[model samples]
Target chain A: MSAGLSIAREEWRLWARSRVVLLAGVIVAVLLVVTSALTALRVADEAEARAARQASAEATFLAQPDRHPHRMVHYGHYAFRTPPPLAAFDPGVDAVTGQSIFLEGHRQNTAMFADARAGADLGGFAGLTPANIYQLLLPLLLIIIGHGVLLRERESGTLAVLLAQGQSALTLAGGKALALAGVVGAFLLPVTALAAYGAARGEPALTAALMVAGYGLYLAVWAALILAVSLWVRQRSVALGVLIFVWLLTALVVPRLGINAGSAAIDAPGKIESDLVMLAEQRKLGDGHNAADPAFAALQKQVLEQYGAEKVEELPMNWRGVVAGYSEKKLTDLMNQYAEKRMAQEAEQSRIVTLFGFASPTLAVGAASRTLAGTDLATHHRFLREAEALRFDFVQGLNDLHATKLTFADDAKRSADPEAEKRTRVNAAAWRLLDDFRFVPDPAAARAARAALPLAMLLGWLVLLGGAIVAGARRLRP
Target chain B: MIPALEARSLSLVRDGTTVLEDVSFTVAPGEIYALLGGNGAGKSTTLLTFLGFLAPSCGSVLVNGRAVAEDVDGARSAIAYLPEAASLYGHLDAYENLGYFLDLAARKVSRAAMDEALDQVALPREARGRRMQSYSKGMRQKTAIALALLRDTPILLLDEPTSGLDPVAIDEFHDMLKGLADAGRSVLMVTHDVYGACQVADRVGLLRGGRLVGSFEAAAGERIDTETVHAAFAAREAA
Candidate 1:
């Protein structure tokens, strides 16, 4: 056998005989399996619940009784976001981002019932999810196993004997790295199986592949880093201390700091502030509620001139409906402008956090995993945009119904005369004619493209860590 | 004929401090050379320089006529080393440890060969299969010696090989060294045990302050006395 393999075999033998290492391995394996299974079940359950809620909301909308088209607009629709199948492997931002949005006329509501808000106590802990285990705990396990790989030899004086026996330091280091990499592979098996199951169950194959590739690179980075530290540090205890500190700094501390830094770097307006601004803009532009408001007097005159009519009575259509449509369009434009600004700000915060990935491979892999799973801030924004578009179409369609189907004479007399009020009610069949709001997720290629940067950052870390290992090996001596 | 090991005016500096200075020595084939020194006397530093673990600031260490710095692996392949307290993987059995290190040295041995080396080193056949962690210091030494025998190198480098062994175990270890010397292998030992050196070494060198100051040889059919070796160390202290 080659010297590296021989060394690795001895390490395997040693690990087998060590009850502590064996017990640690078993505990980590059990944690991985249980967390992965629970995450898959939770994701699947949420998806089913969201689909059911969406169906129920659609049914309720179409079942409305006869009412004025404007009343129907007030009874707005609900849009529920469905998680992609691969979310089982990595729920990503789904734990924090809200899952359902309320859509109505002249208003866009924020998504509500986010887990972070609902499960406040547990949200800070991330609920023992699979991604959390891989991100936080698995690397710790690697550090425990590998911190002594070289230090033991040095402490025991086997290093001198081995060196004098013609064993190159590179071969010894390579052997230890190979051994730890084997452990990494074993740790990754259950998660890889979960990802494959997701792919087989109709999740995008390319996304599953990318997720697995990303995690492989991530774990490899840890293994290389652990080995490098082991070889470079002089004492076993010191090596362990250094590795633990590294794990804490990179995995636990830096991500939180990066998020805070990112938030500090880019400011996003809160919901109330944005709502107040939109309200102010709405007032400044024109109130769609009153047809005779001075804000639309100019619009009314322009309409009269375009139709060559001197007054509303001479117009071909109910001028009230035309005025309502114009006001709805103006309000929709103002709402979209503010919403886009807020999304841009949130995106900037996320970008700042992504830049820190260059320093911490853990964060890089976490970002890539979320992006590929379609559970990131970008995906959340996409859902909101799609929901807004659907809302505009649904509300505007009702406005068109008001313009063409309901007569202005009846609408104007409805409050005073019961018969006129009854005549102004459109048929409930119109609700059924409106299309359901369906959110189509971005294609696998698009998500892969979006995630490509973080993934490359992770790969870059792996390459740099490989260089460290090589340099450490070159410097190994007794 | 090429000497098994030679150091000509070797000097080594570590961390900007000179640890070994102008040391010269040679161990011909089938001869045993023991170096005696107090703590910080640069005995271990000399061995490390010979193993190419530390490069000399001046001169060179040659194994079988090849400079250690110029061809470290080639020089190392000709040596089997035993540290002051030879340590093996605590979890592995003596035989397994022997096989592993032998394989590390690019020598694959059969089970019977491993058993023979263990037996030759006087380690009990039953104890060879048990974990080395439970073995006593003497047994660990025997295991290290068995590894050296299995390596079958031309030269053996031992750093205080008998320091921790009991008197009886030390005597047996001296006999083992004598047997290796008789078998045409050169041995260089670094130790504080003057009597142990007199018993096993053909020539003894006294080191003081990183320099070899005095030497005594055991002529044919003659053994160097303990007092003669003591006087050499005393003379250096007086000077």
Candidate 2:
């Protein structure tokens, strides 16, 4: 056997003999299995529940009683986003971003019932998913197992003897790194199995493989880091302390700090502020309610010119419905503009967070994992956008029915005249004509493209860390 | 004949302080040289330089006629080292540790060969499979010696190899050193045991203030006593 392999084999034998190491390994494996099973179960339950709720909402919308088209518009509809399949592996940003959104004409609602808000007693800490365990805890286990790999040799005067036996320092460092990396691989096996199972259950095979790659690179970074520290530091105690501190700074502290930094760097307008702004813009632009508010005078003239009619009474269709459609167009356009601005701001904040990946590779891997899992903010925004589009289509369809089926005279007189109100009611069959809200996920190619930057950043971290390990190996001395 | 190990007026300065100065020595094939010194007399420093752990500020260290600085690995391949209190992996058995070290030295030996090497060093067959952590000082040293025998290097460097061994174990260790020298291997041992040096070394050199001040040869039909070795260190202290 090669010297490096021999060293690694001996290290494995020693680890097998050590009861504490074996116990710790078993505990980590058990925790990973239990947590992964629980997370998968929870995610599956949520997905099924969301699908059922969505079906019920659609049924309720289509089962509305015969009523005036405007009244039905006021009733609105709800859109519940089902969790993506990979969320079982890494439910990134899912807990914080609510699942269901209320869509209506002239208004866009924020997604409500976020998991984080519902489980506020845990304060965003309730979801101890397997991904979190692997990213945060497994590295600590590696540190504990490997911190003494080199320092013990130094302290016991074995390093000098080993070197004198013609073992190059680089080979020794490589051997220890290989041993620790093997531990890392063992720790990752359960996670890989979970991902493979996820893929087998009809999840995107490429996405599952990407998740494994992202996390595998993450653990490899830790292995290299632990080995580097173990070889560079002179004392076991100091190495332990340094590695623990690194874990704290990278895994725990940097993510939180990055969020704060991102928020501070790019200010996303609050929901209330956005809503108030959109409301003011609507009022200034003219509420779609009034037919002769002078705002639609130009629109009225345009409709008349197109039909070649000199007066409203001469028009074939109800002028009220035409005015409503025109006004609705203006309102929807303004709302879309505001939504785009808000999305831009959110994107900027996310960009700032991504930039911090240079400071901590953990953050980079987290970003890449979320992007591949399709639970990121961008996916949430996509859901909202699709819901908004469906709302426009259904509301506009109702307005079209009112213009053709109900007479202009009856619609105007319905508030005062009971018989006219009865005449203005459209049949319940019209509701069935409206299309259902369906969210088409972003294409896999698009997700892969979006995740490339963070993935590259992670790879960059690995390269730099690899360089440091090599440099450290060169400096090794008894 | 080429010397198995040679130091040519070697001088080493650590942290701007001279630890070894103008010291020179050689051990021929089938010879044992013992260096006696007080604390901080550069005995260990010379061994470190010869092991290529440190580069001399002036002069050179050659193992098997190759400069250690220019060809560290090549020079190292020709030597074996047993450090003071020689420690192996506490978690690994003696045979396993020896096998690991042998692999490190780029030599692959069979289990029977390993057992034979252990036998040569008087390590009990049963103790070969026991973890080094449970071994006494003598047993650990014997394991280290077994590794050296497995390496089969022409030159051996030992730094206080018998410092903590019991009298009987030390006697056995001395016999092992004699056996190694008779087998055409060269050994250089650094110690403070004057009587032990007189019993086993082919020649004994006394070092004081980083300099080799006195030398006695057992091979030259010279009867060197413990008092003569003590006087060499005492005179340096008096000066």
Candidate 3:
């Protein structure tokens, strides 16, 4: 262990003395700091803007003039999908997906006002978030710095001296790996601080801890891989070339392959096609607009039976409002079925893409980081689901007022009689009955649960590469 | 007593090519034996087999009477190797490189002791603190010799130990090596310097085409004749 520490310390001294390597490390660290700051600012500005807009929306809803409850239903509220707090570290899919959904009656709305759609060239392959840098560039940096350590030993005749000193191959490899891990840890300084920062700010500690561990394992895999390859190849140039090729294969090429393969393997319906199918499916189901049609005659009979009314006018409440309530429920359920199916398809696509995480550490960490940050597709789907629930609740709340407040005769004669139309309007204060919509993210435990598979894959890579290093170290010769 | 270093019928074949044949030699304790050969004569190959860096196709090498193949660590623990053109870390000064390599051997030395070893090799005190990258070939060779000396092992393996030294330093190195041998250390050095081998070595073995062609041993208080070995070397190359 002392010998290993000696080598590790020597490696550090050598690196510090090397101006080029030190400069590269400084540059990467500066980039991480700058990107981290910029991402934090962007997330803050976005969250503030969304919150302000949401507040304004609620104020406008409550200030509405007296009107028929149906008109108030059309003045729908907006649920802004608030950025998950740790998005400063990893924006994930948040940049591409829309943030706000316009919740109204009858139709389920797609989210809107996405950063990508607003011409923000960010957060995907070109993403400069701290997570992106850690995932993509950190491994490359490790490869560039470590590709020559073992090769230099043989090239400089130091291996023979080291070996002749009773140093086993295992010790040499262990020492080299220790040195590389130290370098990687230096890179993680900002990451560790970011986690602590997130934890202090009330992001789930487990999620933050898992994110750091996932990256730790990921970098370990690279460190071991670099050492193993350097030990296996004797020539300096060959070791460097092979390591660079591997970096490109895993970092650049394999991730793209995963996405393309997932798309080809399980092609989900395009947005337009999905929308059209849902529209067609809705048409074949109950026509909520014609509440008095034969399609809802059974619903009318059920309502009458519940009220024990001899005639529609004789009932205590307006029958049209009752029909509105029943029809909306049936229509909402149909929409939910389609929405869930689409979500399932997308989740399947993600699953197919994630299987490639085994092929690339970049993919594994990216998946795990995004899921932990609550910036993944699953979170977005959750937002839509929550918005739909709010949509139904508010719409139903207005429908209930429609049923209880207005008389059946007043609603029927309102279009033809001006006096009845005035009386048919419910007070705008009724909008206060609706609750303000706040997006509650999935519990931290659930998000961590979802991240398990990719994190395990990262761990698996570490084990496989670590084992190879051990096996290869035994074969190392001067 | 068992010989401090021995190669019994040692042979090596690398990449389907014979690098060393069934050659045999041993250096007893307190003796200096030099294996002299021209380039590609399997001189370095012999040293590597003893270090367990390369496995011989047939036969075995032993250090301190233990087969190197069976207890490589044990064999290596007793030996200090100085490879040809022995490159120290250019990024580190002499003390740091020496300290690192010595530490790997699990030996501890004080700065004064390091300075002493450096002084014995005649490396100027002023140049010892500078990175070896700034040093000339001869200076680097001197630092490597210091490292090997500081290892304090029983056996020493020097591959072309005086390749870059001037006449004065080469003589100084030979005397230092002789002093180590006198102190009960065994030396097995491979070199193509016929005159230097005859000047310092107690026994000189001529290696030709992976075979030990001839050996010359000095009598007590006498040195091996250089011209005789040189002519044999020249004749073998001519053939």
Identify the leading candidate in terms of TM-score. Answer: 1
After superposition, which runs of candidate 3 have C-alpha atoms over 4 Å from their true positions? Answer: A117-126, A301-311, B166-168, B219-222
Model 2: runs farther than 4 Å from truth?
Answer: A117-125, B219-223, B237-239
In candidate 1, position A92 carries an lDDT of 75
Score candidate 3 by TM-score against the native. 0.95
For residues B1-239, what per-residue lDDT tens digits would candidate 3 score against the true structure? Answer: 89999989988998988888999999999999999999999999999999988988999999999999999888888888888877689988899988888777777899999999999878999998898899987788888878877887888899998987889878888988898899898999999999999999999999988999889999889999999989988998898
In candidate 2 chain A, where is summed lDDT lowest over 10 consecutive residues? A117-126
Q: What lDDT is reached at residue A53 by model 2?
A: 72
Interface DockQ per candidate: 0.85, 0.81, 0.81
lDDT: which is higher, 1 or 3?
3
Give model 1's DockQ, 2 decimals: 0.85
Instruction: Please state the CAPRI-style docking class of candidate 1.
Output: high
TM-score of candidate 2 to 2 decimals: 0.95
- The collision pairs in model 1 are none
lDDT of 2 by residue, B153-229 (tens): 88889999999889999999999999999999999999888888888898899888788888988636554676777
Give the least accurate 10-residue stretch of model 2 chain B, judged by summed lDDT.
B218-227
Candidate 3 residue lDDT tens string, A60-137: 888998999988888888888777668889988888777898878888887875665222445332357889789888
Per-residue alpha-carbon lDDT of candidate 1 for residues B111-207, written as tens digits (9 for 90 to 100): 9998888888899887988999999889999999888888888799999998878999999999988998999999999998888899889999999
